[model samples]
Target chain A: METVDTLIIVFAVIAVVGSAAGAFLYDPPASPKDFVVTFTEEEHDVASEESGSVSGSTISDTVDVPVPMPNVTALELTVTMSPSNSPPVRANPANAVIIVKDPAGSEVGRKTITWASTESGAKSVDFDIAQQYLAGLPDSVDTRNLTAEEAETWAAGEFTNRTATGIWRVTVQISNPGTVPNEETFAISVSGTATHYHGQARLETGPISGAA
Target chain B: MVKTQAAMGTPEGERGAWSSRTGFILAAVGSAVGLGNIWRFPFSAAEGGGAAFIFIYLVLLLLIGLPIMFAELAIGRKARLNPIGSFRKLTEGNRLWVGAGVLFVGVSLFIISWYSVIAGWVMRYAFGSVVGSYFDDPAGYFTDVQTGMDALGYHIVVMVLTASALAIGVSKGIERVATIMMPILFTLAVFIAVYVGFLSGSGEGYSFMFAPDFSEVDGSTVRSAAGQALFSLSLGQGAILTYASYLDKKESLTTNGTIISIADTGVAILGGLMVLPALAAFGLLTGENAQGGAGALFIGLANAFSNMGIAGYFVGTAFFVSLFFAAFTSAISLLEVSVSFVVDQWNVPRKKAALLMGLIAYSGGIIAAVDGEIMGFMSGSWTDAILILGALLISIFVGYVMKDAIDELDRGGIRGVGRITIAMTRTVVPIILIVLLVLAIKVEIVDQYFASIDLFGW
Candidate 1:
């Protein structure tokens, strides 16, 4: 009987220890690291191109010049054209043709902007292209006035390959078609930033220049 | 097989007998329904798989948990000893088989030590709710009371109370207390559940709880449900074994186990209804730390109460009181196991055993409660490790070494449906327990598997 009692006592001790050990096996440590991330937004500037003065005279005098602008990295550009609010009546293409050129004079990216009227009583157009194509463009030749045929050729180039940025030009021809005061050609530079995953470039234009 | 009529002596003049079948069931249910039901179950369900987890947990409780509970009870009754001596007798005095019972008692004591600390927190919260101290800053109130000397003081107070109950012996003290407390617990839970149901926009909370999200069903969820089922049933620990020792031979062990398991599972389900819906109604169900640890329940309920205004205070007090009762009853069982060891083995008087056990538990609990890190380690890592290993040993002893006696004890008294349950309890249940015991040891898999569930907003 004493042996039995001694055995029971031993068993009780073992039982307590065994249960503690078993429970420890199931309870693991909690993680100490935090694995959450947060993001915030910041402000920046937009890129644009500058056109030089049109020095030619007479109805047939035509000058082909490239606009100057900063190098854009990865950006989608859009351009729109409508009769200027302060303009004499002018007949022109309702859409603006956008062309991007690399420093090596190769066509990299291009798009056409269509005019749409918003509730603010303003007609505007826009185009979207990858910022990478704009980043390769030359610093000079931001905007130019193009003839109808040139716009068609630019459209073909837009579909084929990207334009390099050495000398890029956009041309807008204004014709007095309606019974209104006549005016010379009008030039406007579309401005925006070229943004990429790595960074972005800000481009600004000089003032708009015109030709008669 | 040599059958010996071994009279494992109790302390002189001590009558530690269960009064009736009702007494045994109520006491067992008291041990079974605890923080595991209110504090653990809803959070587990929310973290496991919402409604799908509830479904799987219920099935596992009925299938795996119920039968094992019956087997544990039957073994205890047959041996008529504490867990340590029961296994020894079941194995016809094989010393190795006694390891399972020893492990169980150790785990129970460890659990009792820290469990008292938590019970103290409940008591403190109960008081705070009455005085409106929690309303000012509920979260801060919980943090302040849950750590440091205040927690230690309450833990000692609760531990002493539990020891006192056990010292009065089983039938008159533990059973009688449970008889009164269990109904109040159930009634309080049901009342809270119904009251929460009437609150506006409670329908959404109900839908979230009852509506099954089939997408969440996976192997990890199933395993967690299984673990919760076993834990909530109070299996493997000698609580049931100790309770069963007082049971009369004429009682149908199978029938009693089924009834107790059903009652325990019912309380757990009602507890989920009480908590989860309230959490949903209050929109406190989201957040990374929303469903981990005991703090989750306090935080969630406090948030719910603050939103509900003055009525929240009365309801909160009632809830914590019920929680206190549930925890108090379970703690009594834990201390009783230690007392039984002293009385059965050393012929120590019940009162003396209770005093010794109480002192030891109080000291351990004070160490835990004063140091937050120690309390976490005791409750988290220590409890899990001991329980899993102890359960494994118990499963092996019941399934393999003492199969004959287990079968014999399962056969007598139970009839009709009870007899069928006995057959399943003897064979199928033991096999499932063995499998779970093995799976629980693959610690990496279990941890990674449970971690992968996106339930805690992870």
Candidate 2:
């Protein structure tokens, strides 16, 4: 019977159009194609909690986001540190991140959120604190308008919270003693097309033994 | 009650005839669209060469996947029997393929039993998504939901659902549930995918999934793509053959196969659309934090949704509900594959067959519901071996054992496709399946072989 023909046709059209648009919108194969992956060689520096800086391992987990000029629409860039699978699934965790540049740097769209650690019956499955954090971001990228609590709450927070894509040149420098040699060959690949300031990669200091 | 019904005996047409071509298409597509379309497919696209993988997958489906599907359908239509009876009838009393049908029945039971446990988890997750069960701790939620009597409860519910659909008989039950569920599955997946498209900075995820990053193309990419195409289509398990057995002879198997293939591939690509863009929008797959694995979607989306506040609640509910529907339809087909055999081989009625099999699979479902050693063993090694071996056996039986395969296909108006199907089933598919089998064993059992021994303190 032709009862379901319309349903099939509608989905068929969606399939064709979405796939064709995707196929045409981007051409990655024509470019360099290979992923140039490299890890940061930072010293195992566990900084003091008061200062939030580790043993000089680039001030503990710094993230660099290459950005266009500071005045524009919102953008989001994420940084995660883990061992790569030629195709990765889950990898070992790298503890912390410290985005370089303070108030001046922070002004360029700074809201660092720690990834949520879910708990309790009320927390439920669909709750995503990170998404909420992103949604809470102001339409304007100006950091001066932020309340003190907002600045502190959003400033260099963990990977789970603070949401919405913004223009932040984040630098995450990991100095985990628990990390083995070459556990994670870190790679920094930028998303979004901004022409202004490219979030530069900060060098991590070596251990005393290695430095000697 | 079912036993009494079985003793009375019903007519064959009720057990066999599809209500219409549309009904048949719905059922076949139902069998194909599953958790793989939602959970596995997106992760796979991102892992392989993204768009390049898509390109290779389509090619393989056409040159490889579709022909075999046609051949399987042709076999069923020609013989008009369950897998065992059909193979036996086609081969004219040759015992070589008798095991394939039996193995298919076994594999179907094994797969469905294990699948129910997972489907139950998806269902619970759907409920939890709305009610905020894991909002406090997603990892803790996964840990809690993955095992124990709570999981068993969900498993039982899923098995009962599967039985109910089957109990209603083929036309009213299987056809109706499938026709309703498959459309919802497509609509929900597309709905989420379109929403993701409007995300402000989602180009990265889209590119990562569909941009054809050819440099990532390698043996693993091709192997994974080929393997996915084979498994995602629900081949090798005789589900297709069983569904086809119920088809009207007038329906063209080739056209049906093409439509099913398109729908399956479309859902899968759309799944990628749903996931990859959302992750990119949330900043999940930056090469830095690209925790590329099965959990990436769960973790990233959990973060994204949790951050979305109230809107995330509705969106999350929609996604999980869609997943549950997808899992439900596939579970029905898996149950039917085995139930079909019981009806044909024995004098059992359809309802009785569904009940008896449902109860049996339900027992295994309990064990699979556990998140411990026993559950892992059955779901991991036991099921994978059975499925791979089933596929290998089907390919070999059709190619080398069944002499009238060409004629069987020719009976369905398919000419050159028979030769191609035989060639792939005999040669290419079997060899690749072997590799997949070995790799699975190496990863699941052998790699852990030593650890398991230590675990038991033997």
Candidate 3:
């Protein structure tokens, strides 16, 4: 019994000491961090009528930016209206999946992108890559320059840590109305990086209403 | 108090006293520490600027939580009955007083109903940790487990555990289990905090939890902090009062209340250290990528453990197991309230009373588990409302109605009682609680209800 009491006392000391050490020695990120990623927009415009539901999504075209999606901590994607009068966009398929394809049209890796918006009139949503996307990412994929094209892959097979990195024909899908204009400009930029406009947004309808 | 004490008549030797002071402390501490510590407190801290909110909670715990606890303990020790019986015994002829007692028991039962459902979730997570089921996808796993038959199945498991502990009777059951399990629970909480402290990136979590920004202090923050302080200590529902009723006269209510409050608060702060660091390290804060639900957001944090490599499985399992112990101990206390009620009032045997109350609470748990709308109403709005109302009434009864209440506070001349306790509970705490109750209802019920109405455009 005395032994048990002593053990508890020792454990209690460790808990207090350890917590105190953490409290004093460890400091949080004192300031809020803002991420910047440049998006090179691809073709994306899948109509809900063709997709059969307001929640349907299809890949337009993938953007190649300086910092891959994994590197940026968070991103706020804003939709610009063609008429400049579209209601604030309501994004569906709340989780957008970005698939990495090799130059040969072979698949390498994929990451799911999550975003949050208002109940209505939400023209933009912030996607926290570190929290939502990267936590589930395979260690095989390098987080730094996570989506740099295949040329960056280690040479001579002398790689200490290797992951399939090059992505070709990435699929960036979005659903819900007013999120995309007929000829919307997809802007891609990394946090703390210069904001730059990318290619024309082209929406592709997937498996249509009669999709198999 | 004097009239009822004589008229209601006293039954000597009807109930067993706690075998030792340690036993009493453990039982009260066990009841106070549970999901409130793990589930709500950290989330409140996160919402209220981490350290700043914890500061408010501690202040309230001292001013509001401690005084009310002492108030309840004094009443129960003197009356030496279940909450309903204690009230009936204290104010023998007053139906309103008896009604207040009924409300006390009802609130305990109500809280356990939803509480058991969440405990069931903890059980499932603990089980999943061993099999590596969520190794790849924590979000997908929790979403699947949180609804339908999955939730009900686990609620039943917890309900059975609660009944079994209580059926064995108070001393052999509550006192014995509390003595053995409380140490284990405390050790688990501390060791988990220690592990968090050692983790490389966990410093951010500690910073978020322990260091107050002070800028985030606001009305909603106060509401959340105060409700949590009272709720974590099991103040409103008579759990502490019930446990104290089992204490010997030689025991100092003030000293015992302080010990229970300190132990309860220590475990709660430790829970933040255990959980928040991991959540921050994994980047699992509020975002699209974050898990939904106000109080039950730890699922997002628990989901991150699988990503921690081989150590994740062991840590995840141990965390959930400790969670189960925490939940189970508290469930036993809540169950004991209704069980004790039947035993005292209906003259039912302990075993039968345990089973009956357990089954009754199971039906309520089913409602809480199956319907999200109902669960939110009861757990968030109703629980606070009942608890705050219960606290108000208990204070008024003791401070205003009960005769010689000040003299009662002076019992044993324990450290923190007497004129100040009466002024705090009788006057200050109840008034503060009323304002808090109004704010909590607006935030919890009206805001959510209005949001849903807007969502549906009704």
Candidate 4:
């Protein structure tokens, strides 16, 4: 209704037209290139087996796990164990160690687990393999803004011994067999980011006995 | 029934007024309905107990949002000036009240600066939809797009767009754009909701949205609902007040405010329909995957979009385009508050004010884009605290300090609700806002600050 309103409205319309003209007149920045980076989640499980007679004080076995992706964002290993077959054995007080190696046979992750002697029945422990490896690296970088190439390099350095695209080896061992022969049944579950793999871990080596 | 009131008369000295009631409603509604209505509301409802959250949100909207909305419109229309000028006039030059007005401008700047950064991400997503940039690895794409030089570029683009609108003036720039964009936003929202409704597994999402499990309700749920009610309506920051300043007194703030609230809430419900159904269809509505907030919308919904084959492109584009429209309009309103402050308080020309404020806000957002911590602080709990404080101060001013709010509320077609509304504003609104203010401080500010510092190793 006022003179200022009418003039400003006219000016605004002109501005809008000018902006539209500018947008069309000048070339806009190109959109980022389309990238395909699919991440997959898979779990690998090893069947339950009894910790048989220990030649020394440890029982060891290895499982093969397939990782078909080049970049691994996360990896975890979970173990559940209980006293096997022996009805009278209420507690399994043994220490468990897990070691994972890439296709190149270099150790990438290792974790040791132990249970209290008084603990009874089934117990479980989860080890974040990727997190452990990542944590061990120097905390000098903020991963949020890393370029894809930089992220790749950073990831590669942390997981130099942990390739994601191969049949990896995982070794599980039980030690501290004590005089009673603990006789524990354990299952190991491994999970990580990969693509297009049969998500399972198969036993590659037996329950081998080792001298203390 | 909606006749112009001759007694109040048009304020000749006012900068501008909406061309019509419909234009005013559209601009106001455009300000109210934004990303909060889309992504925030559904997640908040789901996390706060679905239907239960909606119920509390509606209640609080009536108790908290509506009164504040009415008060702001009343103050703006009464004084017919920018926020600071309005308070300066209404309070008869009370320095304390004028500073509250200044706080509104400051909060608006803070809100727009960080908001433009986020809206820039939406703009990128909208563009990316055309080329399928984020289709393959939506999660990774989100992380990349939200930071680095790319984010800053988009943020600047958003600020430039908003500044252009403001430089044009109220009726031509904001009202005109909102008139065109609001309908488009509503249509796209409806189209997506109806499209998602036809999906086979969408019933799970509908149930998750509609089925009220009150068992999940808690104090935090109430607090969230209250916060959402305030945030969704764009109350407490003088955007509504500034918009209302450009409104002719013949238009009823009551009817207009109610319509804006209902429209905003409707869009929020529609947003839930679109997002939840799509998530359910993709089997992502439950368990750890059913995360709330930005991650769920950008990453989880992007994953769903990727799985939809060729159709996903069109749908995702429409969705993000609508999101951009919503964010763009709100950004315009927010930037207007500061621009209007500069123009009215400092005697600056409208074009210069818009550019100056826009440039300042844009500079603020550059840091927000590169460093997310500053963005989080500016846009997150601190913003919430300031908004709550603003609303509390407005309620006190309108109901107690200002003598003529009831007269302004009584102006135009609607009448007779002023006494009761004023009574509630004086009594219930302040009490509710006080509670919300304390809750906002405790939950959003103090708790978050302590948590960030890892106080007590929490």
| TM-scores for every candidate against the unseen true structure | 0.66, 0.66, 0.68, 0.74
lDDT of each: 0.61, 0.61, 0.63, 0.72
Q: Which stretches of candidate 4 lie over 4 Å from their true place?
A: A1-72, A80-153, A156-212, B1-14, B286-289, B450-458
Expressed as tens digits, the lDDT of each residue in B148-267 for candidate 2 is: 656677887998899889878878898999888878888888888888788777788787777677888887677667667767888878888888888887777877888898988888
For candidate 3, write residues A4-94 as lDDT tens digits.
Answer: 3453455445434543443354322222123333444333332232333344434344543222111122323322212121333444424
Off by over 4 Å in 2: A1-212, B1-10, B286-294, B381-385, B410-415, B423-458
> What order do you get sorting by DockQ, best first?
4, 3, 2, 1
Q: What fraction of the true Cα-Cα contacts (under 8 Å, chains A to B) does candidate 4 also have?
A: 0.00
lDDT, model 3: 0.63
Best by lDDT: 4
RMSD for all candidates, in order, please: 19.1, 17.5, 16.8, 11.0
Query: Tens digit of lDDT per residue, candidate 4, span A1-212?
Result: 65445544665554455434433442211112112222232333333334445434566667666443323435454544443433323234567777877666768677777655554455556655555545555667644675544444455434434432345677878664333443445555544333211001101111111100
**Candidate 1 per-residue lDDT over residues B27-117, each given as its tens digit:** 9999998888887776677666678888898888777776667667767787777888777767766766676777777778878988898
Q: How many backbone clashes does candidate 2 have?
A: 58
Candidate 4 interface CA RMSD, Å? 15.5
Worst 10 residues of 2 chain B by lDDT: B1-10
Per-residue lDDT over B188-305 for candidate 4, one digit per residue giving the tens place of the 0 to 100 score: 8889888888877888888877789899999889888888888888989999999998888778888888899899899999989889999899776643235456666776777677
lDDT of 3 by residue, B25-100 (tens): 8988889998778766776687688778877888888878888888888888888778988888778647888888
Question: What's the i-RMS of each model?
Answer: 24.8, 20.3, 19.2, 15.5
